[model samples]
Target: MTEESENTGGLARRTLLRLGAAGGAAAAVAAAQTWAWPLLAQRGLVSPDGAFAAASTVFSDALYIEAFPTSPLILSPFNDPLPVLKALAPVPKTVFSKWPQPPGPGPGQQNSLRNERHQVWTSQVGLPDPIVYKINLLVRTHSFTTSQVLPIDKDGRPAVSFDAKRKTYAAGTKRFLPPSTIYGFNGGFPGARINAEYGRPVLVRFENHLNENPLNLDRQDFGSPDLSFLTHLHNSHTAPESDGNPHYSMVAGPRHRGYRPGMFVDNLYLNRPAGNDDGQKQSFFWFHDHTMDHTGANVYKGMVGLYPIYDPKNGMDMGDETRGLRLPGVRTNNPDGSFDVAYDIPLAFTDFRFDDGVTIHKDFHDGQGEFPAAKNPATHPEWWGKTFYKHFPNHGFVGDICTINGTAFPVLEVKRRKYRFRFLDASVARIYEFKLMTSTRGPKSSASLGYNGEELQGQYRIEDGQQCMQFNEIAVDGGLLPVPIKRDSFELWPAKRREVIVDFTRYQDGTPTTKGDVIYLTNVMKMPNGRKWAASTRFSPDPNYKIPLLKIVIGDTVPDNSLVPTALRARPPLPSNWQSLLDNRLIFEVQRGSAGGELEWLINGKPFDPFHALPSLKNPAGRTPLAQQKKGSFNLWELRNGGGGWVHPVHLHQEEHQVVMRNGKDVTRTPDPGHPDDISGEDTAALDPGESVILYRGFRDFTGPYVGHCHNLSHEDHAMMFAWEITP
Candidate 1:
């Protein structure tokens, strides 16, 4: 949107709301377009069930996923092997030099130096052998990769490839040329994927070229803490050390300033050939720097990647059976026509645009913070994270522009045979709904969005009032958590990824000219955080800026016969945990906010104290990592929701849960969090304004420090999150 156009809209919306404010009357307000209307209705800002224009097109398709090396949220098979922990590094450094000279000038007045402190790791997966995979985590020194590799050693890091004349990284490398957005990550975020498979052991080595920042720079200001990274094979994440826990991060490199492990890192992460059940087949999972305050910059600078672990034992590798269906394959192949690439392909999808001249000021004395990029007072207004962002020619934040395989709408050369597309939503906060555009006459870049659950083969129904109840909406910050931003350009919801398969054989033509299987995978992600980006806050919902996130233009291509979804399933069945809720004996109310000397959170309306444990009957994990303290061995524990600002996803890390009492009622229709494999599904009742709901969660496995917060990443980041111990 242009400046003038935005200004006009802003004035109009604000004026409408302000003028409508009259005494003893409902305000004729104009809420943020993207905010949820249902929430507005509850707040009395708008009438209930108001007509809302379709924000963006919807989708319906069964997505098949393949797990691999890295991850979005690592998903693994149950039989997966234990993880193998190895220390590899090309680790970056946080270099510092004491000002005044030392006693004898022993080392030329050098006071201190430390390797960059971002958590980086490389893991390999092979169906048979442990192969040597060279993984490159070349973080832009002081991270200015979006502008390409700026040669200047700005902020004390190496600027080998950047140009002094242009003040930006070289125009373009192989993947990045022109008309493409530049973000962080060495060879693009999520790096490149080679060969991987389920139930196999492999090794990935890091070429640590990260040097010490001579000019002194804070580590956390740019990317995640360099010293904080864990190679979670996602589903197969084993060892405690490799778990990438916020509290258990470690550093790697020639430098040994890494965090210590109180116990053997014994999750799947520490095993050699990692294997763990991913629970579900068609979803996205991954790995990242879980360090506090470092998540934003680190992921922004490309320290994130995908982990698509496929269950080979499952019928997942039957792509050839579905002749027309394309299968995404990242399998370790034997090459030749006899190799595993038969009908498999890999698509590591991620794109990031950078703020030009990005810079950070820090006192290498200790990894603290950084200086925000400079701003043009006349052009750019002061923003939150902006006060610390330092860089020139900022490209600004883009949840819109997409680069599949490091290029916008990149074309893949596939054989006449079937192929698979392993998709991962690596964006910070965007829910994507993508479709493989194909038509009989030709290819179209759009899909038919008729979310009428009626068009299904089986009569699988959750039948509300009988089996489950629907969730109500809650609004905060003058809006809802999922700030609805759906349009012709993009749809990006926080942390939503989809995996789809495309078959070239079905299309008959590749593009307009070639009559072959040439497919265009188009994505329409919900971009709510756009407002957050503009306001320098990714959590709070605001109606200030609207932007398109991503668009796919095939130019010209032939369509395909049809696209097949993994399963025509809607919601899963509700678990039976609710039956035991009557036995609850312990209950607590959790709240969050920045307090005390550092940031703080609370439980039962009280700030969280590390030395304290909310009263509970038994340690759910029996002392294992999944050993969370159970409210009652029978039925004494309860966490009732007191409708407030935001609705936390309230995930119990070790076990799944189900809704039992929503605002004081036994709603059979609520989803069964522990219900396993019964099509009679349900939706978990959501917390309504001033409402109380009851949920039941049974003990599962390993007990360790787990976080229960809003699935909404933004809220979780801004202190609306907390942690608990499941100890006896």
Candidate 2:
């Protein structure tokens, strides 16, 4: 998609309507390639206007990097992220100080200036071993090892990395190095992971260092207030003060008019079980930027990382080959000559786009309002370093590039044995339908007509290419399932985590599959609209959306010591007296706004007003949150989806719920097509358009504010979120 394709051509409404008409998946795809692409070309839906528009090749060109292979499972030396958070010199007072500054003092201005915020712990898990971490948010640049020649700017200067021996920044040169500029935690993209142990407490002190960024910010069009900090550890059981609620955002700079500027917040997390039962304990969680209305931009800039809780008593310690369920553990250097690597891995899935092929897009910021091209000429023009649709696109940000664990098209070397991979969809919007298939080849760098899902179907289709392996489901968002479910392919929505055991020793046919064999973890869901793929869309034979994520090459045969247990810890079953509790059911509706000049994603019909909760039968004043529950009570929460051609992966903070019913039917073990398990006792649920789900959620132990909202960062940034409190 070139700048020339930005024009919306006159493809009559009738044609666009027919493209979505009822038909077989093949017909729909044929219509898309035959008619939709052409119309979209005229309309310029693919190519955004401006210098910073994502390169058309991002969508059209197939990924082709092979070296710089292994995906890094970001683990911190300590359980806390604070050690990595260091202080940088303050920005020199100058003309470019309009962007907020870190409050307090300059480098040599004051001797007493220091971060003052502290945390006070309440509950304990097993033991009270507390660890503290200090993390800073800063803008920096780093080289992403890739094979594609970084695209050159208009001046013919290379945008890629420079030769290590010689580094120079010269215009119009074939050999210039320009690392991707990004906003990151501790200046590291995909910030460090926290290996927290159950029963131990962790405290993180977050400081705002964005003011020290060398980049100019006055000319940006990013949504929400700039230079603010609100770090939220998603799905953690913590107090409201540490929950990272939008209302409690701390802006950088000096205090003003009683609203004092805050430079830091020490968040305390009690890595304890949701209840006395082991099933209430959570295993996988991640922390990211949750600034009021700017979550999408901040997170996209790389403020995300993983946090896996290890409970020795709960079989979380895979390192012990003798004790517990000795699953493969993380790789570790051993004192002996041999190595000690846990085939257990973590994959954080994310998408990013570089303006050309190297300089990543940076969003410009405007105040908290939509900037239309007609009214805002200065900010509307697509420029280098901006998203395709300027500030914020209502549809959601789905990048053309797919990155896992910070690498693009990387390869993983696995032993011929069972391994556990924790997959987390960190994409802002894209929903992935993943499958494992035998090797298939296409042009390494050919123009792939993105979204023509049916075109390249035959070769990679499972029937043509053998089904390589399957995933034995072990855990969901909050924690482990009651029983392990097996599946060929699984779908993961943003913010959802699925942990599975994959054995490379045996192929689908139970043949002795081993070394030299190659398989790809690929995506098949045809989602060109940043929403759910339509029902008529064919996913099986879809080649248009077929993109290999990780290439797994079977290596040497390893000792088989690990085993997948028949069952995992069990979550509390639905209250046996549910019929008597029907009268207490509470409903929340997720909807899109009708006043549509600009799109408004909402919960109920209102935009987020953090201070005001929508009025409900339980809260007559509407001022009270939707549901103010007693700390230990179990309540049936009904989530009703307002039909609007979207699937919302609804996520709730602090508490994990058990699905009681979906669409008025009792939740059962009957699995959906690719998902071979039951959807129950999960923190996040995928709510389809026009569907309704009833869940049993318990508000126990800790008390304070929490939220339930669409995990879609774009939607969450909008008003599709609501707050509730747990009373003591």
Candidate 3:
């Protein structure tokens, strides 16, 4: 298609009007003739009719339907039943082919593992519901090379590096990523959950065998087809190459003559605590594609998976009920004789938009594409998927469907026992304020309290809205808190994870709850435009996202083997020299700008650049550094929000930092017995406009490149990130 034609393409308003008229005349005919789901999937386009259905289905699919879990909860820490030890080059060609369609569903729809490469480790859990049903696992192993290696001086002194010719690679065409298709780790979606031990040394070799040419890159006029990757382990103590800094993204394929293609990158995870201090160790971390200019879209396409670390000897080990902390763990086989991560469940919450034909949605926009800044064109001839406005892309995308562990509005049969839920919001741009409530069969009531005395957070017109459940939050992004905090509800921004323990057998007051009671996992934060949430007490929830997420039907009682501890782990005291470092704190101003009819999310007035060296004393050369710190050193950093009525969840990689103060005032520390330590540290913090936070971060145990960015991936993808180095 010509550039002019592509620019003019999309489901225009006039076409929507025609579809409306056709729908009124004959609903069945409109559905049949316009819903070309298969063709739409193949071509990556959504017709006006499909767009309309996709928009309205959110409320319809979630509000009225009552569903139950037909499959067991997915357990992580579960090994790939079929682990492929050998690696292959050029990634299997079939890796980019249309994923096989599962039986009785949308054509070319991929929900579970069906191919041989993927079948080794993944399997599907079938459900009878026709609305939308499928569970697919993503897995793969590829081999490729790259020359984007970090440079060091001849004397082997890091940071004060050498190789002037190596610097020229940045100016070379080959400096950028090669043409390749994107896929989840091990080549599958929700990639495999990697279970590693804290303080352990492990080597991970990532080979990029992405298809040399993927369909999304076919149109040179739109979207990023960069076939390189920068895999960040969120907040792990790893060398620079493994930190997955956007500035250090690596590409595959043969390099120009004499230059070897930088395809594979080996990351060494020290697995040590952020500062070598036992109290600062992180338990739950994840790995995902962090390629610059494409983190958001790449992750949206499913380049994310779990990487949970543990201190086998001193950790909350769920490996066996007889060892370690003994909390409900993986390896605890279910009645079906299949094993899963038991009470220690990882719920990866994400949202998606589908075309009216029910295929996944994709919006193509290269900085130079027509309507590059606009989500939809006011007047266009071809369907460009669904949009709320004309010609501009949405500030943030929010799908009508909220999926957990890859299932849409499904049911979970929980035993009348305590379960530890690890909630990770992996959405590209959706925030969820979750609440646990019970259902009522008759007309919805206006009650704001549970049958007993549980304090309800918001009004749920879907049923008798009683906030019957409460969560004992044990940890934040960094790991387990010094102590737990019990709250009626908690807000989860994208890319944030919270560990909470919920006891299904009792109410908040320790009263034995009914054995057959049914409850729901609901969202109440009403985010109409995917913007900042309203200011309100944690208990007084936002009513906007009040949709049901999971249905919990109290099942038969099982032998309870887990217990929420009185204390998990305590954080160690700061280094004695911490006070001195505080005087020279690093300050990052989260700023935004508008230019050429587009909004820019930035840090310190600059978009992310890997080579933009920082002016610092340690490395006088300032080799493209945003911030610099000596290895094994401690420093204070301040996150300042540039007011614009927006909330930024700042996430720091490579280490977890403790939030010491907010808005110039010391944060009141909360002590809970459920944790082994006090809650004072975090990897991601939500900063409201006009707000600021001071964090104490440690750059210890490793030296290399790392990143700190807004976890609201939409913001990060648009340049709200920076690269920093740890010097030796």
Candidate 3: Cα lDDT at 109: 24
C-alpha lDDT of all candidate models, in order: 0.30, 0.56, 0.52
In terms of lDDT, model 1 sits at 0.30
lDDT of 3 by residue, 321-433 (tens): 55656565545434422234555677888665321111122232322333343332122212111111111123455554456764445567778888878888887767777
Candidate 2 lDDT over 1-728, as tens digits, reads 12122112332211221221222223434444554556556656443221111222121111111111111111111111111211122223241134242222123111112322322343323445345555677767644433423333323223332332234334323332235556677777677666666766666657777767576532233422345657788888776666676533322112110011236555667777777566787678888877755677777777787777666674555345445666556445434212233566778888654433233222212211232222332322123322222223445666655667665556777789888787888888877777887755521321222212222221122223445788888888768777787877778889888888888899878888768777778776755445666322234444444556666778999787787878776766656777565556777788764322023466766555555445433422233235678888887777878875677888877778877677877664454433333454677878877888777788877766567788778777656777676778
Which candidate comes out best when scored by TM-score?
2
Q: Which 10-residue window of candidate 2 scores lowest in summed lDDT?
A: 64-73
Q: How does residue 693 of candidate 3 score in lDDT?
A: 75
What is the Cα-based TM-score of model 2? 0.73
Estimated TM-score per prediction?
0.48, 0.73, 0.65
What is the lDDT for 596 in model 3? Answer: 9
- Error in Å for residue 45 of model 3: 38
TM-score of 1: 0.48
